[model samples]
Target: MFGRGFTLSLSVFFTLFIVFLYGPTVSILVLSFQGPNGGLTFPMRGFSTFWFESLFDGVGVIDIWGAFGRSIRLGLVVMVLTVILSLMAGLAFRKRFLISSFLFYATISSLIVPSIVISLGVALEFRIIDDAIKVFGDNMGIQWVVDDFRTTMGLFSSGLGAQLTWTLPFGLLIMFAVFNRFDPSYEEAARDLGAGPWQTFREAVLPIIAPSLIGVALFGFTLSYDELARSSQAIGGLNTLPLELRGLTTTVTDPTIYALGTLTTAVSFLAISIFLILFALLRRRTNKPSSSKRSTL
Candidate 1:
């Protein structure tokens, strides 16, 4: 809105901010790979693969890996659940009113609730359910499976649901952003061509919004994976990476904790890079044929 000088000033400001934030992160990453570790020397006491080797040498690396895997699975489930719930809520409230406002505030409140408060409520509720199981066991022949597969699933789903309190709001916003720009004419055309509602959605609407859906899924999954407070509170029996990392940092003061931190950051960076590459490829694939057809026309 101003001049090139304004843009240059903004760029410089952001550059300084990024450097300030990432400088320590870069230093730790470099230090994590250093072989000889006394404290935090700069020049490194001769290069060696000690740090990387130590990752699996003594520490419970297998447990860390298991936690990482569980986090990934939980993240995927949370993302899917968030997307599904958001899609339904968004579509249902395309025309907003009092109900829409109420739903919006209700969904957002879950995000605002303190993690400790939510955790207390969840724990108390489960305890009551356990008590009920005992009472039922004494009265009836059926003993409730509080620790069974079904119960575990319920806990997992509920934990993810607690995450969805905020996840759904963001997801819904994304869906609305996508649908706002969508051209209903395409759907109408599909119908005019004798396509059914589901067929129109599959063939026309989906293709138009697939990128947004994928973007939302990735964003929500990343958020869920990195979340610690909610995961700690809601996940009764499961341990996620963030929780594991915290426990290690607190209980075990090993230098390998730095290695774990470096690994986590590296994995996140790699995932982001892959997503960017895939997005660029998708855009190229979508554009090339259209450009070629336009040239021929």
Candidate 2:
């Protein structure tokens, strides 16, 4: 339906868009293999894994491995919580009750708010909690709480909450889409087959929505792993990988930073690959012919 000129223009535009999107990542991946004596700029100074080696050997007092570990742990936790809470919320919203619309809007409002504001709010809330604890401890003569107990803005607490504010909306939205198109006859058939509520979900609803849950898990983990703004103030005393990477950009001017970037990108790709593979497998299983039907055939 289009002319040759339009087709050529569209192709050129897509090509340029792809290049613009991935050009910097490609540059970083190429430069990450810089030799031991190489600089960060152009003119590829030999090719080796020396910069990657430098990353392991300790890059100027910063805890790269520690930050990576924190990011991974937090991402896994966020993934699990997002899946559970979003699934529950999706199921709850399936039935219209009082305040359902209000709750949904409240959940989605987090997405429109600024991420740094969420970070600061979580931080301030935790500070208030700390103050409250100190007062209570002093009044109750609890020395441990007054003296030894510190802030509660660690990885699994305020950090998790802040990241959830970013991830849960996406998860809930995915679940909402998944359930919206869901066939209710499957549940009816399962009920006719004498299945209970849990069994009906397990054999009918769950299998159909398994792939979508995997997608939600992927979104959760990836978002949490790469989160910087919401995690900045909430992750007290320690840093996640993204935060460390930002700090490294200012202090470390070598290609080792590029190596770090390449490594983290590889990790993100690995997580995405794993989730996609699982999704495909679940889809195949769900679509497979039943053994009883095959035998009858």
Candidate 3:
């Protein structure tokens, strides 16, 4: 809608904006590799991966690799669940359901709630249930497993739930944005071609909206991986990467935290790259003339 001059100015502005935003992240990444004797600021003494290796460093109760693995696993589960549920909810929202409006607003409310409050609720609810489980174990002789499950694997349970509370709204909102641009005639054509509901969705609708699904998955994974607030209490006995990083603040006075931040940022960047590659490939595949004619929804 603007002239070429305005367009060029906007482009330059965004370019500078991106650089401004990523400048600190780039600095952290560089500092992450600071040498053994190097301070956190600058003037590198040498270079080494000592900080990375010292993540656990037999330091304390923290298990760096274990927490990292838990975070990855939880992020994947949350991503998959978010994509599926958001797509289903989006489709359902288009129909005249009995409680569609109620459900939509409920989803919105979850987004509006403070992360800490939601986390507290999750923790309290789990505590109550665990207490009940303890009573049951006391009587029925199933004590060991119930006693320390939180320390061992509570993230997959309560932690995943807490992450979902935040992720699902994002997924649903992305689905809404995607469905906004969707043309229903594509689905109608698939149905006209004798495609069953599932078949139509699989062959037609999904391929068209695949990019947005990737977006939802991307959101879910990143948010869950990087989440600190809700995850603080909801993660139960064991900590995730963010919690580990926070715990390190008091004891760690080196580039180790920078290394951790760099590692996390790399993983996040890797995820983004993979999703972008997949999204591009899907777009290209669906954009092909012959394929588009038959498969584009």
Candidate 4:
């Protein structure tokens, strides 16, 4: 229906948009293979895996592996929590509750609020918790609490909460969209067949929503994995990969940093690939019986 000129213009626009989006990443990926003596700038000095090798050797004084582990663990925790809590919230909101509107807006308010602000708020809140613990320890004569207790901010505590503030809203919004378009007849048929609520959901509702849940999980894991601003002040005592990467930017002056960036980007792509694979599997499984039934008939 469109003219050839319009189509050509649209294709050119899309090509430029793709280049604009990924050009830096592609440059970093290419630069990461620079030789051992290579500088950060161009003029590719004899391409080699030296920088990638250097990443394993060490990147300055930073704990690269430890930070990676922390990010992975935190991302997994955030993923599980986001999926569960979002599913709960989505289900709860399916029926009108007294404070549903208020709660939803409150949950979504995190998206509108600045991430650094949330980080600072969580840090301050945890400092208050630490103070309370200290006071309690003094009053109760708990020597361990008094002498050994440090701040309450850590990966699973304040860090998890902050990342959730970012991931959960996205999860909830996804779930809301999924459930909104959901066919109720499936659940009704399950109920008619004498299935309990849990059984109904497990057999009918859950299967249909499985693909979307995989999407939510992808968002949860990736968002938490790459999270920096909200994780900055809240993740105490140790750092996640992104935080470490940010720190390395100031200290490390080589293609090793670019190698790190490439590795992390590879990790993100791997996560996305895994999630997409799972989504496809779930979709195929969900459709299998229908296809078989139609073929048999």
* Candidate 2 wrong stretches, greater than 4 Å: 292-297
Candidate 3 pairs with clashing backbones: none
Q: Per-model C-alpha lDDT, please?
A: 0.71, 0.92, 0.85, 0.91
Candidate of highest TM-score: 2
lDDT per residue (tens digit) for residues 49-158 in model 4:
99999999888788899999999999999999999999988989999999999999998898889998999999999999999999999999999998899878898999
> Candidate 4 has which clashing residue pairs, if any?
none
Please give the ranking of all candidate structures by TM-score, highest first, separated by commas. 2, 4, 3, 1
| Model 2, span 1-297: residue lDDT tens | 899999999999999999999998999899999877889988788999999988999889988899999999999999999999999889888999899999899888999898989999999999999999989999999989977998877999999999999999999999999999998998898899788998887778887899999999999999999999998999999999999999988999899999999999999999999999999998997799778533422
Cα shift from native, residue 31, model 1 (Å): 1.3
lDDT sort, best first = 2, 4, 3, 1
> For each candidate, what TM-score against the reference?
0.83, 0.96, 0.87, 0.95
**Residue-level error in angstroms, candidate 2, position 104:** 0.9
lDDT of 3 by residue, 70-114 (tens): 889988999999999999999987786999888889899999999
Worst 10-residue lDDT window for candidate 4 reads 288-297
Give the local distance difference test score of model 3. 0.85
Error of 2 at 54 (Å): 0.8
- Model 2 worst lDDT run, 10 consecutive residues: 288-297
